[model samples]
Target chain A: MSGFEAATAVKRIGDGRYEADLDGDFGFAEALNGGYLMAVLDRAAVDASPHEHPISTAATFLRPAKPGRAELVVDTRKAGRTAATSLVGLVQDGRPVVEALITTGTLGAAAEPVFAGPAPAVPVPPLEECTSMLPDEGAEGFAGQVDMRFDRSTMGWLDGTPSGRPEIRAWFRLRDGYGPDAVSLALTVDALPPVALNLGSKGWAPTVELTWHMRAVPAPGWLAVHGTGRLLSDGWFDEEVEVWDSTGRLVAQSRQIARVGIGVRK
Target chain B: MSGFEAATAVKRIGDGRYEADLDGDFGFAEALNGGYLMAVLDRAAVDASPHEHPISTAATFLRPAKPGRAELVVDTRKAGRTAATSLVGLVQDGRPVVEALITTGTLGAAAEPVFAGPAPAVPVPPLEECTSMLPDEGAEGFAGQVDMRFDRSTMGWLDGTPSGRPEIRAWFRLRDGYGPDAVSLALTVDALPPVALNLGSKGWAPTVELTWHMRAVPAPGWLAVHGTGRLLSDGWFDEEVEVWDSTGRLVAQSRQIARVGIGVRK
Candidate 1:
């Protein structure tokens, strides 16, 4: 695991229970990044159930996890024939730090076939065609792991131009050689807010919070991300992003809340 | 107004903002009810800006409102030449209660019109046909305001049956005489979870939190709600709901997080 390294090693403590220790690299800043925490939880969800099933997980950031080491525990609350429920907790020093609930099950055998809205008609720019637009300050930290390419539609702090539109569209992929698992897929999906904001403006903005929902897991390959930033008023803004596989399958969706201000990092 | 009588009294504070006292027959429970909040916030978005644009809004539940008095505030964060952004905050006793952000603006001159996939071809059952299938307990609070009919292919909680598959489709409409607006539309859209859960099992569950996003406002009359519940391995579940107009246009989308334990409402 290079770009998609698990910050904490997951250990099954007992039936439906597991633990892990937190690492400092997982911290996006002063605290563990929401995306990092989500990635950890995603791994635990897949481990809890080996079979392939659509999993939906949501987490509320209760407290920030400190550096050094933390523990993760998973408990199976209910397991039905079609669907099962699991609760995971990230703890440090025996105290609960973060908690999440995840659901996974095989796709139903309904007579109706799969139906999805058409993939947005936005064009996908090649990785080499677009400029590398990451946070200048945080760029060094995440560099060489996840590579980003910004098309003309990109907005936010990296570029000084603001389209002022609530929606943003962009193309993204890993540096190469990263396995396309739920955790790796999540890392790429969760890293687009900075790019979305850049698509809106010619500057950089750090995301204060993010929440993601996977409509269905992405196919094995590079990914396309389309994000829309709505309701940016009173120093706060919320964005919804839809991720599509290379073949145009709607894979995952994410929402983020960020506090906006006039500060630039060189 | 009946079910909508309380929400109708809410006074608009300013651009995309409104306020209602937490007192009277409609108290904190009604004000903080997920459906009611979604409706009010939706209306405020339209009130702040009219049909010149299409809007999308999402709310995060911070804390519950106290049953006494409260105020709702909305502000347009970004009003560019084309798209605009608005924020709505529900404040009680001078403290922030529930906060929502909305983005609405004109569809730019279309070089070409595009849509993703077609809507699912689920059948719509008559409202009268599905009423008998509602869960016996707490059926009164829900059935009184909204009439629901479900597609025969889906699964639910009513009829004392354990949830088979984890998805539901239903038609929803106000009882009668509820004029169309943001508030009424919100209430009608917010009321589908219980009915959707009816497809799960005979067990009772309460929504602890709810969030909604709308591509466009629904038509002013009867609406159809299609929802799917993903039960996590933990004792919690989340429901994703999409409300459609009679014409089949996707009107609004919503998600609710709820604790899943069997018990009677106090």
Candidate 2:
């Protein structure tokens, strides 16, 4: 009954429409691993909306599915009290592929903090001594889905060099027994922008493309994330991450655009 | 002599590194929008080397411009061969506030194609031209930077409400802009999200954010962009567009994300 609950399955197809099937091993080798299809469409948009509130999702990836069954259909365009919006689609045999949008609500007083700045002391290190750098080895199949560590002040993973400071900070979670939900905390806050563009580049970086912006949604515990990156000489790279949760709050904010390339000179 | 006069100007050191005085108006709104502060530091990358090679330029904000001045400096960033890459940032007292970074070279070998899917189907129009569509109240303070198009197929302008999938479509641009360099190509090839949340959603969709992999820069052609959206239950909603060119060659490609408020509701 495990193995991502027997290779993912979810039907119901009507009342609120539901359909999802994945059969492939969850350690992802493809067959829909964009953060496990964005945590199965963020748990089918929280089962079509149960609401505790706090949402913000964004997805796009037109094609890339090939394991077996991958269908999802959720609906409900708008609900409002404060806000609510949904849309999910990721069909496989019939076409579609991937498309998402979720935007729950309940936290907008706009108190006026205006971005205080701080949050960057950097230093976590401890996931069994932390190591995994990953600039690509197929992103090491996401090294068993998070728990990553890293911290020497910064720039350690990927060993690339440049730690100048467009930023980089880590410490994520998940891995123990899973179950934090919210689509596994948005798949561990979408793996910190390819580890902050391969440690804020001095050389060698890869991501091709990635984007996340979840404003709020964290409660379960122990998360950190951070990242920053912004290289642009044409090799193109952009990262701006944020996720807090050990009580620091924030929760989520991501933006990644990569196409780096340059690490195979041995 | 175009290539934008080889660009040169940007220096505003009060000591923030590219400083230009502060408090708000951030560096005099980037020295009066000197082409949106040369497209935000023209791909930055400071001390690691690489500079020059951006192909386009345009900016216009006027007024503000006051920062520090020491004749100012401009040195964007660059690195190319077959992957092409560039960057240009500026600031000068008398006149000059440019930002550039136009790269072109990646997508190597594998060719053989001629436009297969999106582009050339135009016709849109319905959703009541987008529920009331407002903005031009005489362009007050510039109305959220201008993004109100309904979509009668590609060129509508801005308003709202439409849902997804019509071969993909939607619009919205200008988180900030002023015009010139074709208005930074209206925020570089606007309209995205697997074609704007699949234009209303029903089938076929994938693009968890892939602005053709961003990194190109240069602008001004106009501004005012578009993208209306919808794609329920499956999750998706996107907005962040701006791309103008008239005689620039790189036509259009905005941005969007949608999957509004999932199930339940009533």
Error of model 1, residue A73, in angstroms: 2.4
DockQ of each model against the real complex?
0.05, 0.02
* Cand. 1 TM to true fold: 0.54
Q: Global lDDT of each model? A: 0.55, 0.43
Mind giving the per-residue lDDT tens digits that candidate 1 earns over B1-266? 34665543577756445776543222223444566665656555656774343234455454555555567777665454434555566777776655555555443222121222246555457665544346653444446555666665564354456245556777776565575434555565556545434434334454544555444434566677777654332344556676777766665556665545544111
* Candidate 1 C-alpha lDDT tens digits along A73-119: 77664455545555566777775555555555543222121223455
- RMSD (CA, Å), candidate 1 to true, equals 11.9
Q: Would you give me the overall lDDT of model 2?
A: 0.43
> Model 2: per-residue lDDT, tens digit, B1-266?
21222121234443323533311222222332233243344323222124332222212121244434423234322244433333233445544333222333332122221111222334334444642245344443223333434454442212234332323333334434333332334333332323332333333232222232323333433322333321222243444333322322123333333333333121
Per DockQ, the best of the predicted structures is: 1
Q: What is the lDDT of residue B177 in candidate 2?
A: 38
